[model samples]
Target: MTVERVEFENTFAVLLEDILAELPTFNIPSEGAAWVKECLEYTVPGGKMNRGLSVVDTLRSLRGEHATITPDELHKARVLGWCVEWLQAFFLVADDIMDNSKTRRGMPCWYRREKVGNIAINDAFILESCIYRLLKKYFRQDDYYVDLLDLFHETTYQTELGQLIDLLTAPEDDIDLNRFSIEKHRWIVTYKTAFYSFYLPVALAMIMNGEKREAAFTQARNILIPLGVYFQVQDDYLDCFGDPEVIGKIGTDIEDNKCSWLIVQALDRASAEQRQVLHAHYGRRSAEDVEKIKQIYCDLDLSAVYHAYEEKSYAELCALIDQADANLVPAGVFTKFVAKVYKRNK
Candidate 1:
């Protein structure tokens, strides 16, 4: 890792210590506190941390290169960044349960770990509650405290709604491609992944930097949401085409009956007979059936189609950034985000 990344990771350890130090105020017993600590260690800091680190990066971008960030200010930004990470952990814990996932970040899903099981449902809630707790502790006296709370709350609701759409559209027992579409895929990606993954971190940074203009937020959302959608589309593509060892988990989108981007694209381009083949094997858990679906995806040349879409989306994002108003928020904020995930493998 680079020196800066090492420093950022060191701060993560500090923040975790700070969070655990305060658990006694909640009157929890020692064992419960230790469990929470273990849970936080396992869930909060394990990912690539792009979402968490983006808050600090965005703040720096908004402030410009020459601006000075006080140590306290930098610490607060890191805390807010981890709050975003906490929110993600909360969602993923529950999502893994709902998706019946086996692994995450290459480790066994928390719910699948011995003794975690269904208690992970409540653990997810605890992960969410920690976001507010950290917010209140760190930002309660700031003018934007309410804004932070509202932003997190709204993002959570939007994500949950998106998850609902996904679950309703692609229930494991129900294998109906009729329910999948480009529009639905976009909706699911936008709400479930885009808002939290892309918009929330930058929005938090903007708010912290005191950019309260609604138009500024509107502009950021217009760019960042699409950017997020593109990132997720890449994720969908990678789940099928990228190496599981590289991406950190096995691709279960097909076997799990996910309304994935590849599936929708295949449906869009499938022949009548190919459609029959997909409908036959798309959601089956059997290895043979899964291979059948993969064969169909390969036959349909979804990989080339994905590459085409990737190029188009990247160009559109660049155009949007080029046209963004520099006065409201620096174009570089969006540019940095775009660069991070443009052709990401994980």
Candidate 2:
């Protein structure tokens, strides 16, 4: 890892310690608090922390190159970064149960742990509650505290709505291709993945910096929500085409009946016979059937199609960033995110 990445990891460890140290103040018994700490360690830190790290990145960019950020500022940045990650952990713990997922970050999901079955649901709630505790602890006196709280609540609701649409789109027992569309794909990606993943961290940074004007957030969201959609599209493409070793998870969108960009595009281009082929093999677990569906994708040239969409999306994002109101939020904030995500393989 680079020096900066190591620093992020080390700082993140400190943030966890700080959070753990505060747990006992909740008046819970020591045993219960210990389990919650273990749960937080297991769920919060494992993923590639791009969303969380982006908060710090934005803070630095906002502070500019010559200005030395103080220790207090760095601590606040890390707190917000981990807050985003903790919110994500809240969602994932419940989502794994909803999706019946077997593994996450190459280990059995928290929900799948022995003796942890239905209790993981409550644990997910606890994880979410901890966000407020942290915010209250660190930010209660800040002028933007209410804004931060409202932002998180609104983002959480948006994500839940997106998840609902996704579940309705591809319910386990119901495999209706008609439910899939480009519009629906956009909606699902925008709400479920984009809001929290793209907008929240940067928005948190902006609020942290006391940029309370609605126009700043409007400009950020305009660039960010679409960037988030494009990111999810890449994710959908990667789920099928990326190296499992590199991506760190086996692709199961095809098997799981996901409303993936590839599938939506395939449906758009497919003939009646091709559609029938999909109907036969779209959601099967058999290796042969999965291969058959993948064969259809290859024949449809979805890879080339994805490349074309990616290029167009990248150009559009560049234009938006180029046109961003640097006086308000700075173009560099959006540019930083685009640079990290665009054309990324994992």
Candidate 3:
């Protein structure tokens, strides 16, 4: 895993080289170029990188032995993997600014950096622009190039729409139980998190391997979207119940007015008094209020609810993968994602 991670980091260097080479064509100012480099380095790398690396893993599972794969094939796989990471960086940079988040990946968010602030918004756009740049430079001549471009564009738009829903549903300083429905929560997770995080990687891998059938993409989406939603549900569970040290961040969903899965479930299960408790404490930043909402969750037995949901979701994903068209996508590609997330704490 360490060696693989090292290679992954090395690929970022290759991507940076590509960006630098392309910079001359744009006539960027010297200071602007340096800041762009810094922004890319700061926002793009780090983190667990599971989404990016999953592309390479899925491709390897589909294509057989690493030794048999040519260098060009391996390079394309890694490039696509990094493209997912770049896409994430783009979202996260803007998200931090919008969320007023202080930190990401255990450091100050790009928007919160000492020398950078609102400038990170433009940096986010630059991060997004790099995806097409990298794609055109590497895969422009390939048959699947346009498909890959469309997939990324569509996935990005879907994610932004999800973000719009999320922001609308849980606006800062504007907590309302009416907007925190289970249906809204699921829609937000499906578009915002699942499409880009889960489906895009597998879909990109499929395209890389020359599988262009619309049915194949649809099949991958059918299975992966729910898997991605389950993953977000787990994330919601962890935010309230998980150890901050273990999860690597403090849980603030309760105070952030998030349409969290737990909160949605709580609303479904809460009685009049319990619902009142939520109305008062759900989005406040006070530790006392956060704990009050958590106590309500405990009283409602949401932990048990999450466990049951996990088991059911895992089974459904497995069944879908089992029935997927083997010619279009290997079950292993989906199963690997399932195994990693089923009972994961971090």
Which candidate order results from sorting by lDDT in descending order? 1, 2, 3
Clash pairs of candidate 1?
none
- Can you give the TM-score per candidate against the true fold? 0.98, 0.95, 0.95
Candidate 3, overall lDDT?
0.89
Best by TM-score: 1
Candidate 3 or 1, higher TM-score: 1
Give the best candidate by lDDT: 1
Q: Model 1, 114-162: lDDT tens per residue? A: 9989989999999999888788889999999999999999999999999
Give the worst 10-residue stretch by lDDT in candidate 1. 2-11
lDDT of 1 at 6: 66
> What TM-score does candidate 3 reach?
0.95
| CA RMSD of each candidate after superposition | 1.0, 1.6, 1.6
Off by over 4 Å in 1: none
Model 1, global lDDT:
0.91
lDDT of 1 at 35: 82
> Residue by residue across 111-198, what tens digits does model 3's lDDT show?
8788787888889999999999999999999998999999999999999999999999998677787888999899999999999999
